[model samples]
Target: MSSAQNLAEKPKYKRVVLKLSGEVLRCSETGDPISWDTLRKICNQVKEIHQLGVQVCIVIGGGNIFRGLSGSTDQGVDRTTGDYMGMLSTVINGLAFMECLEKMGVQTRVQTSIPMNQVAEPFILRRAIRHLEKNRVVIFVAGTGNPYFSTDTTAALRASEIEAEVIMKATKVDGIYDKDPMKFDDAVRYDKLSYIDALQQRLNILDSTAFSLCMDNEVPILVFSLNDSDSIKRAIVGEDVGTLVS
Candidate 1:
């Protein structure tokens, strides 16, 4: 069936920021950092939503390649230098993601906070908005073009700038749990949460900076598992697939 014909269902949000962790691209069995299969799966889902007429903005992390905080604390690297390495890693992931999406026939653009004219367009607010207006997927990368900040913060910042209706954060688990779901069998998943409640309970749905930014901007966040096939589509189509933080 044609993608247009498949759009019988409408998405809950017209525009959204899809937050992806670089770890999602890892191959567990092979221990490879960038898994083509995983990338393909993710791009396919993005394509699905794009076909549904949702303006997609993606912000991907670089944990799989490198983590600045971990490098600084664990490897004795300078914080600023480590963060710049992490930002470079995000650019690599963004380029790979853009390649995957383009191969899948979805129009995509990568904008980096740090200017890299040879590789991608510099992060320009007007240009990014114009890309979305033209139904192109815009992927923001390079960790806000600075050190001492995270991609989570970048996601929140970009969402606010683009005026995205919500931020869909794909994680390893199904939803936000009161405790570590992997360690605690009694961990309970929340169906929904208010920003104040999330803050009061200290639910680690996002980093403090990112969480506070979302709360301040009133941008809702949907936390869901990326392992499930069609989960993005389910969430976009309003199927209650994850924990919603508003």
Candidate 2:
């Protein structure tokens, strides 16, 4: 067997929390609603990881459906109200993802911070752990069920609560860059960075609150692009595919 196959057989982490931005679910190429193709692609990636015997939990953002910060200005809504709307958006994404995973033959569950019994289970820590132990992928929705808190923070909080080995942050960019990679020609990417360096230097890998919580809890983070095929598997297998922020 190859080294990658050997590492995959070992299984390093008992559990991990993946943070996916809602924008990733949307059809960015077509400028329409959620794309079935995009959803299927992500589902396949998750399915591949699930087959590896790694317990996976996901926290999805609502930026694709509704960005609170932008909604407040564009729609003339209050900040708190817009944020609440954004939280609901995450629930929608979670449900869609759950359906996709189920279709792929991967048993999955959706746990919402906000009580939505009709759609999913309530956010219970023990129940979540039990699901992981049973080899079910749990998708966490509703973004902490409160305003003024980003989903990035939710990822950290859930990781710490569930004792996740690492936080895999899925972003459009491949990794943390010194400058906006799209806007600058010479943006630098760090292979690995200390938690303090990410905070002090403001690397933009994650929100301040999320970074602080991860640092305090000693939870390492892996920032990578979800669009990259096999990237999730690479991350779980300890391959050098993205920026490692610990």
Clash numbers, per candidate: 0, 0
On lDDT, the leading prediction is 1
RMSD of 2: 1.6
Q: What are the per-residue Cα lDDT tens digits for candidate 2 across 1-246?
A: 898767555656669999998888778788765888988988898898898899999999988889898999999989999999999999999999999999989999999999989999999999999999999999999999899999999999999999999999988888888889999999998899998788778777778898889999999999998878878887887777789888
Superposed model 2: Cα runs more than 4 Å off: 1-4
Q: Which ten residues in a row have the lowest lDDT in candidate 2?
A: 5-14
Clashing pairs for predicted structure model 2, backbone only: none
lDDT of each: 0.93, 0.89
lDDT of 1: 0.93
